[model samples]
Target: MVDVSAITYDALRVAAEHVLAKVREGEELGTEDIFILYLGTIVNELRDVRSEVARLEDKIDKTSQRIDETNKRIDELAKSLSARIDDTNKRMDETAKSLSARIDETNKRIDETNRRIDEVVKSLSARVDDLAKRIDALQTTLLEIQKLLIELVRSRQ
Candidate 1:
């Protein structure tokens, strides 16, 4: 009976040791599950960051294209403005030439009018001198006639 009890006690101790090992293995599996969960969360965050970076890069590319288009438009506008300025300068030069020609023509007409006026004044002066000479001759003739008439009358009386 004593040997049988010793054998039984040994068997019971072995069984308790096996159950404790199983419990330890279950704890290790729970820790491994928690670790896997943390790893999955980290991977998900990295993927989100990569997607955001790609979006930002696309926006930057679009902005660069818009800037290039704006530069091209500005260059075209500058060229147009330069051409308009050149045309305006040409018109101004033409106007100045026309005005100068007209002024020259007006000056020539004024000179001709002054010359004609001078000739008319000279002709009027000459006519006035001739009339004065004729009046003097007529007066002398009248005095001679009156003297002849008086002599004839005296002789008749």
Candidate 2:
């Protein structure tokens, strides 16, 4: 019997081939062969899931970068506006109406930036939470599969 503990993809493939050869010779598949077949199928599914996780991770990274960039731009704009307000204050002879208008516009921009930031934060948090759950699920599935395979291997021993 093949050592299930030492099983790798290549080894499993060879074992499968051997089992098939036995079948062709009108022999029944061994217990190890049955377990290997089941694991092979699960491995294929896991491969696909792993690829999807990678793709999502990349997307999250890009999105996070964009959010950070946007937040930085908003901060810079707020700083610039504050500077402009200070300059406006220094020139008291300037029209009061114009100063008022500028302050109002700055407030509006600040409010909008804050709103956008909140939205981005919420979106990022939701995405992270979703990813965490998916990762947890994946981990659980992998552990469960490992347990089953280990049990099968141990049973043979």
Highest lDDT against the true fold, candidate? 2
Give Cα-based local distance difference scores for all models.
Answer: 0.77, 0.89
| Residue runs of model 1 more than 4 Å from their true location after superposition | 1-43, 125-157
Q: In candidate 2, which residue ranges exceed 4 Å CA deviation? A: 1-7, 20-27, 93-157
Q: How badly does each model clash, as a count of residue pairs? A: 0, 0
TM-score (all chains, Cα) for each model:
0.51, 0.46
Query: What RMSD does model 1 have?
Result: 18.1
lDDT of 2 by residue, 1-157 (tens): 9866456767777876777788789987778878877877787788899899999999999999999999999999999999999998877746787889999999999999999999999999999999999999999999999999999999999
